[model samples]
Target: MNDPAIAVDGLTKQFRGGTRALDGLSLRVSRGGIYALLGPNGAGKTTLIRILATLLRPDGGTALVAGHDVVAEAGRVRQLIGLAGQFAAVDDHLTGRENITMIGRLYGLTRRAATSRAAEILTRIGLDTAADRQVKTYSGGMRRRIDLAASLIGRPQVLFLDEPTTGVDPASRHDLWSLVRDLAADGTTVLLTTQYLDEADQLADRIAVIDHGRLLTEGTATELKDRTGAAVVELDLPPHQLDAAMTALQPLAPRRDRDRILLPAPDGPLTLRHAMGLLDQADLTPTDIALHGPTLDDVFLALTRHNTSRSARSTA
Candidate 1:
């Protein structure tokens, strides 16, 4: 295979007092694609990002960004990567254009080059109108866009975005998504870690789920959903009639929790039709019914739930 844009092998990190933040995590990201890492808080996503960004040292294992070892070649690796952290990192005292220009200068651009690049980036990020406004006067979303613009100053080969949309408004988040897509289309590799499942579903070419410092699974959204090998038929009925609905649908082996009954709908709408017929036979009328395939949320919940259950059993 061609060289991957990023590679990790047996990466491990342990904090003080024996908190294993990452354990033997390994993965490869192809060039020019968006790879998303999904995990609950404390699942080592940030740790991995920091390591790859050359901001943190790993206790064991190796990570290479743009073919430079993150540990041994930290300086070279840093030159090839851009990082937009979980929070905006712009200086509140500086104007938007000044912030980006400063970053360009830091990357060794000449004074004239930095100023020109700053103007280009400000326009690109749709912040040209706010170019002279102090960053403190910008809204949260505007600040985020400025921060992202700063990261692109060096034209990095690999970009790491750690929850880049976390407090952003819906409109700004949409803009950021478009920016990421444009970057990938231009052959920049992007690694994103986000709390939003829908964001991953919409933007990621591939996604990896992590828990307890280990990888649970990784694949495209459709592939991950298909691995579940089942669609769901959800029935919403009156609370008083839920039991009746579940009983009537028992032949379909429905699972009930609270007011909803979910059954495996292997035959898609045919299964929903059959379920409706059973409910009608029992004189039960569903307030709502729908048939849908497994979603990324379903895949995440199932994988994490299984991991938690296995951990419990092992401890017991």
Candidate 2:
């Protein structure tokens, strides 16, 4: 098989306290696309990102970035990779332009070249108007944009973003999304670690879900959602009518949870009709109704629940 931009096999990491942070985690990311690494807190997402960025050493197994082994060719991997960690680590006193230029200089650019490159990147990130202002004076979004520009000083082949938009506002999040998409379109392979399911749904061509130090599943958003079966109809009936709705729905649908009525439906029209008909017969009136397909939430819940149950049974 041809080499992927990033690949890992049996990757394991144990911290100083002997806690297993990553256990046999393996993943593959093809070239020139966006791949979202998803997991809840303490699921080894950050550990894996640190290992891939050469910031932390894995105790066992191997990881490759841009076809270079992370252990043996750590320097080479660093040369071809750009990493933006979860925190915005920009020097607060430094202007946005100065920050990016400093990064360019660190990457071996001459003073003049670094200045020019910083200007170009600042413009690209839409921070040109604020380029000369101290980063401390910028909003959270501006700081993040500057940090992103700093990471791209050398136009790296592989970029690793660890929760890049964690504290950003909605508008800033949208800007970051556009920037990431443009980067992928320009053929930069992007690996993004995010807990936000909607971020993965909108940006990633494929997503890998991990939890409890293990990789659970990976596929396109739609493909992963499909694993859970079909669309769900959630009926928020009044508290008093909940029992009636549940009873009426359970017989006609695949599942019902509390006040929610879930049906394995291909489309909404027919399912809506049947559900309304049943409600009428049962003399039920719901306060709210929602139609939801197999969403990222469903996918995450299904995979993690399966893994948790399996682990529980094994320990028993």
Candidate 3:
């Protein structure tokens, strides 16, 4: 990653109905990296993407995409960026090649140039064999890839993906991930927004967690996980023993996820040992117990919980 490809500062947007979508949110994204934005529904992830893609204007503040002001030089910014929304945007009646070629023509390419470019991109995106088939016949993953291919017609310097994999199957999701990595490796700056924690953990070189249209935190996966806790002591037991085990470990302030009890191990091995000792003293025969590093899910939960609690207190 090098240089700020996207710069957003003091950005704010409010709807006519008095809904504040963005609250002075600001973040900078570097060139040639897979940057991910993680947040819940209505967190303003889409709003931010729309602003950067020149689809919507921010009510206040400044945003620069590809070194061009999003509001002032909208046309220039549009030329340097590509965007895919939450769902696939394609004509079901057209073939994959036709779709890409059409987008190319819209980008000012000649008919021949558009056709040649579309043929080349179809191969690159693994749709060459199915290029002639109507888009309605393609699978969900193929539709997504085609939509992404459409975005690449102009060779955009900045690509915005807002929930690109939503409602996609596991296999399709993996395919999309590989394409994103390849794009970044080829010097394309990608800005991805997804609710899938693993998507952010595996693909993003850096991640920004936003809430209420404001940035809560931004860093690498490891950095964000470190803010939660050092390790997790997970205990697995039978249904009957769950209550006893949790009650016995009450002093540790354990939390339950499904059938397992999760205890924050800030002291790492020391906490693990303490937990084991407590279980032993209580004569609880557990099915299994393990220690592992905190996961992205843990980090997300911890951050959101903290923010919600703070917001509640502020209101109180």
The top-ranked prediction according to TM-score is 3
| Count of clashing residue pairs in every prediction | 0, 0, 0
- Superposed Cα deviation of residue 7, candidate 3 (Å): 0.4
Candidate 1 structure quality by residue, lDDT tens digits, 1-316: 3789999999999988778889899999988989999998888999999999999999999999988899999999989989996645578999998899888999999999999999998888899999999999999888788888988999999999999898999999999999899999999999999999999999999999998778989999999999987899999999999888888998898878578888878888999999999998999999988888888877887788788877654322
Give all TM-scores, in the order shown. 0.88, 0.86, 0.92
Kindly report which residue pairs in candidate 2 clash with one another. none
Model 3 global lDDT (CA atoms, 0 to 1): 0.89
Instruction: For candidate 3, list the clashing residue pairs, or say none.
Output: none
Report the lDDT tens digits of candidate 3 across residue range 1-316.
3559999999999988767789899999999989999998888899999999998999999999878899899999988998886645678999998889888898899999999999988888888999999999998788888999998998989999988898889988988898889999999999999999999999999999998778999999999987776688899988887888898899888999889999988888888888888888888877888889999988888887778777654322
In lDDT terms, how accurate is model 1? 0.90
Q: Which window of 10 residues has the lowest lDDT sum in candidate 2?
A: 307-316
Give the candidate order by descending TM-score. Answer: 3, 1, 2
The number of the candidate with the highest lDDT is 1
Give the per-residue Cα lDDT of candidate 1 at 121.
86
105: Cα error in model 3, Å: 1.6
